[model samples]
Target: MTLTKDYKVLSCDLDDTLLREDMTISKYDSRILRELQKLGVNVVLSSGRRAYDIENRFKQIGLEKDGAFIIGSCGCEIVKVDKMEPICTKVLSNDTINVVVDYAQKNNLNLGRNLFHYSIFISQFKEFYYSTTHLVYTCQNPYNLEHLRITNIQPLKVDYEAIRKMCLESPPTKLFITEDPIAVSSKILPEISKVLPLSSRALITKAYFCEVIPTDGGKGPALQWLCRNYIHCEMDEVVSIGDSANDVDMLEMSGLSFAPSNSFDVAKKAAKEVLNWSNMESAVGRMVNRVFFNGTFLMTDEEKADSKIE
Candidate 1:
């Protein structure tokens, strides 16, 4: 099959979809990504991660200097990967954040503050560290509120009522709430959906956390935006591959979607095709070879067998 030149962009989610379990990109995955880009496919990283966090990852992969676009903070911020320039940004007002923080303190609930292009702020440093270890490595920056730079703190207040109001009113691109995020997300996602908006989707990357991103923010809108605004391609020409609930939107939105064997049922249902192998087995590289390069590539027989097995 000849791949179309019309699709020039491949927008992808970061955590469970693109990055491996160790939070590192595999050699196979990176080679495939670079090859795809050389074939004229623009790879854009889209995630609920903060822009700085995602930027650091891309830098690790040597893609930070390659002119990719990153949609971070659940679409609240969009930036150019090469220059690290902010293309657009949306922040909750300071007064709004303060109100939410005050409420959380009064209720004895933990709250995390996401600073713009800086570190996150929290009321209890221990709670924050325990909750966000997978996403953020621990920092020595003193938890003392007095010592930390006030300018870097942009507090994101955590309150269900306030969050619900925000959802009803302005509606942030994403919102999430979990009592024990690590325990609830991976095992029981449908149950979590009970409290969340039906229109929105949920993804659990870390054991204790679940993300509530825009129904469109999934790989779909990110790809759509890249196609229309950046690469000027059509939706039907693009192809996406992923696994898990977070990959659902992108799977549905892409011209063609592929899922690994270990993917969640919801993601499998949405995928156009399911790869026989899982991410641990290099499914990403196999799919890229099949779709983009017409199958003339290096791959293990197990991988090839898996691709054709089902």
Candidate 2:
């Protein structure tokens, strides 16, 4: 449906939609995003990464001041990018965490938790699940676990008992389960959700991940809350873009939903339209162009040439 009003909030996924193959936002993508914000658009960086991690990325790209309505942990946390003030947080209760941990332990699944300000990981093989966790928060999924080892984003390790204790002591914004998505979805998803109360939710974010969260959490519900309570705009005044199964709910709820050509077929199916260009080809810049320039997303030769990531 074409929105009668211009979208106020442009919620974009970080991993694939904005961050290209090298985990860097292209120059063209970066330029156009700030331009849109100048057009009175609030750029919402929605990701499964911790807020601090997301903020650090923005700082690296000099867009820390440009991104607003920072939503993290797959919508379990919402905070303003400028002051890092939290607007909302959904933590899984102790009872629910115990049940999920028991299941993960039995299946030898890798379990993790992201705090609002920090990260805590609980698993038998801490290093084994690094790339998978990185994918949910950063990209489609990293091809090299070795690359993650050299990076500084590793989560603080804690045992299963510690994970459970932390959940009881202080709830996690979201619970991250990294495994074969198909395996988890088919073999473990039903079991995970069956034990949780009606207030909880579980989702398979990618081919190798499952994000168990509060039922009230997820991009769709989070966006609604932000719109109704903070932005005070109608649902039709938001644009959302993403590239994975975790992005489905947000895309479905957006006024104008877009999926890059590289996006999963399932995610493309959920969007209002699909971009012909993939994320590698400045797809986000093109999408922003479409939003502003009457559906013709193009770049000048100079801008196109300047768009290449280092």
Best model per TM-score: 2
Which parts of model 2 have CA positions greater than 4 angstroms off?
Answer: 1-5, 64-67, 115-151, 295-310
Q: Report model 1's TM-score to 2 decimal places.
A: 0.65
Q: Residue 137, candidate 1: how far off, in angstroms?
A: 13
Q: Model 1 lDDT vs. the true structure?
A: 0.57
User: Across residues 1-310, which tens digit of lDDT does each residue of candidate 2 receive?
Assistant: 1222377988888887887767777777777777676667777888876666677666665563634677878888887766666678888877778887887777666776653333335466221111223321222233224224323455555667777776788787677676665777687777887877777778776566677888778877888898888888876888888998778899999888999999988789999999987878888787777776555544667667766533
Give the Å shift of residue 287 in candidate 2. Answer: 0.9
Total backbone collisions for each predicted model: 4, 1
All-Cα superposition RMSD per candidate: 9.8, 7.7
lDDT against the true structure, per candidate, is 0.57, 0.72
lDDT of 1 by residue, 1-310 (tens): 3453456666666666666665666666676676676666777777666666777767666663556787776555677766566665554433433343344345443333332222334464311110122111112222213212321333343344554354444434444333355445544455545544445555663444455554445546665676777667788777777666666667888898888787778778999998887766667776777777677766555544533432
